[model samples]
Target: MNVELRQVHDSDLPVFYRQMNDPESLRMAAFTPKEPADRDAFDAHWAKIRSSDAVVRTVLADGDVVGNAAVYGVPGEREVTYWVDRAYWGKGIATAALRALVTEVPERPLYARAASDNAGSLRVLEKCGFRTVATASGYANARGAEIEETVLLLEG
Candidate 1:
């Protein structure tokens, strides 16, 4: 797969919405919107991010939009995040997308968090040079309960 990242286009929102609503993907992601099926809220969230200083990008593979990657938050405390279509899981797309996102930002101390049980995401973050710094519990809307989350950091 030729994984790459590019500025997010208006046409990509619907694709992202569908990908994000996958039941399995939502469970794995854990920390997601309270209502993943709420189109209005989803659009509102995307609009907020797009208008902010967030560095958001669409992840493409072989010229097809496969997911999204972004780095958002205040400087010195920005966090990196990515979501690859479940169909593309286990194919190195997430790691590649994350690597590309970090490269574009060129900032250090990027942070990430993943459901502790989500080894795949943890592995992807680690592969992209993020190190586990701590573990905390948070309300996972998808899981409908509090769960352990692994905090990771990438520092120069």
Candidate 2:
């Protein structure tokens, strides 16, 4: 599938909300908002990011909105994050989107974090040149418990 990233539009928020709330995706992502179904909070979060200095984009595959990708945080400490519809898993879309995003941002030493058990995400990050640098435990709202998380870095 042809994957591309574009500036996020207001219409894309609904699709992102849906993808973010998928139970399976949520569990795999682990560190998610405390209430994924709360549309108001979701909107608020998006509004905050959209107005920030972050680089956020809508992930389109074959011209359809399939997910989202972004880099956010203070300079030198910025991190990358992405979400792909479950239906498109294992298709290299996340890796492609992330690669494109990093290229666009032109920031080195981008960081990433994923649940230690989320092999798929870890693999995607690895394929995009992110190396595991540390591991830590955090409260996973999705899993409702403290879980191990992997920290990754993509350096210049």
Residues 1-156, candidate 1, lDDT per residue (tens digit)? 799999999999999999999999999999999999999999999999999999999999999999999999999999998999999999999999998898888889899999999999999999999999999999999999999999999998
Per-residue lDDT, model 1, residue 153, is: 98
Clashes of each: 0, 0
Please tell me which predicted candidate would have the highest lDDT against the true structure. Answer: 2
Query: Global lDDT of each model?
Result: 0.96, 0.97
lDDT of 2 by residue, 99-156 (tens): 9999999888799999999999999999999999999999999999999999999999
Give per-model TM-scores. Answer: 0.99, 0.99
Model 2 spans > 4 angstroms off: none
Worst 10 residues of 2 by lDDT: 100-109
lDDT of 1 at 66: 97
Candidate 2 residue 138 Cα shift, in angstroms, is: 0.1
Error of 2 at 54 (Å): 0.3
